[model samples]
Target: MHGWRIPASVWKWLILLMAGGLAVLVASELHVGLGARLPDGEGSLRVTLEDQLGARPQGLGTHWLTVAALDPRSPLAAAGVRPGERLRFDRPLDRWRRFAPGERVDVTLDSGRSLRLTALPTPVGLADRTDYIGRTLIVFPALLFTLAIGWHQPAQRAYRSLSMMFLAMSAAFFYSFWFGAADGPSALGKLVQLPLNCLAWYFAADFALHYAAQHTGHLRHWLAHAMRFYRPLALASAAYTAWFALGHEAPWLWVPSTLSIGGGALILFLSLVDGWRSGRGDLRQRYRWLVLGLMCGGVPPLLTMLPWLDWETGLGRITVLAYFGGQFLTYCLLGYAVMRYRVFDFYLAVNRVVVFGVVSLLLLCTFGMLQHWVAHHVSAGHSGFGWQLLSDAAPAVLVFLVFNKLHARVEHAVHAVVFRRWAAREAQLREWLAAIVHIRSSDTLVAGLAAALDRFGDHAGSAVYLRLPDGGFALAASATGRFPPRIGPNDPLAVLLRADLAPTRHQLPQDAGVLALPMCHRAQLHGIVLLGARPNGESWRPDEITLLADTASQAGLGLQALRVDELQQAVGSLHAQVRRRSVELQAAAGRRRFGMDALP
Candidate 1:
């Protein structure tokens, strides 16, 4: 409560400001680092990641790869080079991306002719720039996700912990790739890395604690205990880093780095595992991608950073790529998951993801084939750049023409296979909608309406309220006991429903987790359907809201029609009794005359 604290109202803005500052500093550092590594000599080498990994027609694992690309005028080429030849480097593919200009890289060819390949002392090469861009792309999106999720649910523990985790992770990755210094990792970056990683470690636990359906508490208590241990170490580490930066001989800070990487990663992984074990179906699904991300992103660092294992880069391109690949994929997937959490979950999140992906791939492949055909068959006579452009444009135009229908067909086909289990639930929902039309009884209509909503397993509870003779709506049927018994004519829910006859959102709130939709027919509010909270704590998706609204509309009409039918039957019965009474009276009139006559 003492040192410095921003008010809750402006906390999101504070985070944004911090992000901006960090981005500026990172950009400047990257620019300087890239400039420092600029090639200073005219010498050149044309090796890419694929070239360094080697060109093999067939083999397995590390045995399949490792070859150096040699430009005709380059030193490696001048020495000796041949087709289908292999070579080995001192470092893996990742390290190759960070090679400093004028650095002589030692290699051994398949022919046993060992040589040192002098990396051209020139500007940042295409491969290096590409690597930097790719890693940055991966980090920034995850970072942005943190801001997004936090902004939406600022009070939630998951948002704060998740945001901090990615922030630290992004910073750590920046240090990994850019290193800040041309010669090696910057002293400043190294100085901050320890504490940032430690912070990440603690936040990982914080996320674990809060990611459940219930949060630990509403306040930020993440650093309560961890800060006590982290502070003095941070001060000492800062002093040591400054000392080392001044060219003094200081002991390398392996202790803190090792502890942070190992401790933080383990804590994250174990927490996720614990949650998975404790949670149910959809809740468990939230952890799978995160655990995978951790496994893929965590293992390499543990194996590499720990003093015991002493992991090295000689484990082949595949291993190295997988290491980086894991981080990239993990972050990308999380970014997607966090950003689209509420907007895109129905059936199975993963299934829909696959459906979209497969459809997109099919479209791309077809378009590519069309382009290839046009390039080879239609572009033979094309000479000018404009003509070539026209040839390529033809395929694009054709693809665009067919894109919508083709995408729909492909998407539907993919969904049919991918979402086989969910398909039945969808069919059941449609069947429920259809079944409502024939429901003639008022009691049956409202009961059936509640059951229809209950069929889809999202809401915790559901209720159907029908308009009474006095103009108030009373709960006619409920799948669960959460809803109120009656909504009076002057009740806010009733007032709003009367005004608009539409669905209510969280704005005009009553009880928690309740979404009220009006059942309207001929512009009159016939009934109201209230759906309780989702069990997983997520908002109702668009498709779900659409389904509920459609159900409410049809149910309203059916209820209105049933009421009309009952009124018609009552009137018809009254008419039949009146006619029968009249007939009896006419017969009695003749009998009464006979009785009078008899009495005289």
Candidate 2:
């Protein structure tokens, strides 16, 4: 992007599209299939997933089911099930996937009692659906963003690595969502998922290492050394996951994952520090955005997934959603990064997504949390129907009322604070535009433009070329440095301005360190604004250039308005002089016709 062009690969795009479609299909099946008649285990059961109760029996491979509500209609209740009681069968629950409809299964209770129960699939509830939706929301953006990067910069090695890393991370989340065990023939892919999880951490760390190593010089040598073992470590971790899947008790599974993530985190932190310390301008800003996104996206999962935290304490299904909320924030940050880095020429798309996506996510997330909190205080079983309905709808109602206002504030914050330089300048330009309308003098217009140009540019020396009556321009106002006193109508600058009103490099003396922005209204060229180079020696970005050109457009319109005002004033003065002369002639003629009056 700095100089060379990266061509998009057609085959890569087709593959990405196919993969995205498959993902959508899989997610839809998982979501819609819930509570539907299971072809194999043709039954239904309602229970919240909770931790194992007491200890597993010596013969009962692992605890299968727990946490049953006292629903008399449930198949489990017919087996005399109680809350917090462990339910298992003659075999593991994973093997019960093939039971026919109405097939009898024997269950062993925690009290050493045997009861016959029918095989049942888990029931889908609102909470379940919410959790499922939230998880989808979490990983969806990663795939989309990965696809975007692949489409935009597939040729870049760093970007390709970045896309792969994001894809792996999303895959890991897909397997880990709901935190359920692989308990069915349908879930046989969980064996592959274990290895995928480990790959996620490895790829994340490796990508971060490479990205930082390339950008920050201090970390290059160590990062290169780490890269030497990158493939080996990744293969080793995958092998360990396979061993774990094969019923081997390998505690070392986490060791490699931890080492990879830890290394990556360390590299990102150091790169951030080094960048802010030594880097300048846009490069430093990019490092800041990337680091911020990592912290925001990665830190919360660590907190939420902590062992000590009692997830059973009213956080049951919501904890999963909490994870979704955090991941979405990370996506927002990534959106900003992609735009800021110019990875794609789609800033407007990303901007709307960042601004509106953050707001909508927060709105829905708040609604979900409020609903969860209200349900905790007023028990659904005990509360009146009206009270229950009111409680359930309150969160939605609240968010609905404030949505417009919230979106406004979020948009304002994005423009005024987060994207200060890029968007805030537009607001300032409007103020300049307001001033330009009332003042009719060309000097005032020139002075206002020069000031605006200097203020928006980084310590810039800005000057405005005043348009003359004979279709020439003269240097009228300079906010900082000098320029050519006068420009001929036949000069190349005038010809370019008249033909097309776009900014071009100023090469008056060759290496003048200036940009020439033409001011035009309608089809008429009015003037030109000269913008100096930044003190940091970095050129203005494309977006910034566009903004300045917009400012020039405003200046041109203002100039046109001033010309119209001057012409009106001149016409009024001519009319007044004509009336006065006509009146004097009429008085002289009357005096001549009256003879005495003429003598007088």
User: Against the true structure, whose TM-score is highest?
Assistant: 2
Candidate 2, which segments miss by more than 4 Å at Cα? 1-7, 18-22, 29-134, 177-192, 206-215, 239-251, 302-312, 316-325, 336-346, 353-442, 454-541, 550-600
lDDT of 2 by residue, 87-135 (tens): 6554433332333345566666767888776645543344544654565
* Clash count, one per candidate: 5, 1
Clash pairs, candidate 2, are 591-598
Indicate the TM-score of model 2. Answer: 0.58
Error of 1 at 374 (Å): 18
Global Cα RMSD, each model:
11.1, 10.3
lDDT of 1 by residue, 1-600 (tens): 011354545657766665555556566655555334322212235553232211221211232134435456666667776545776554422232344556677666778888887766555444444445445444554455445544544555555666666666666545444524333434344444435655666566556555663422322244334544644554455455344334333443445544544555655666677666665434555666567655766665444332344323433333344545676666545534433333212233443553365346446645754665566557655689887887679888988888888888877765565345345766787898788777778898788778767766454678988888889988889885477788787887788888987787644445623577889887888788888776766555455576778878987887888889999999999999999999999999999999999994
CA lDDT, every prediction? 0.58, 0.60
**Least lDDT summed over 10 consecutive residues: which range in candidate 2?**
52-61
In angstroms, the error of model 1 at 20 is: 5.1
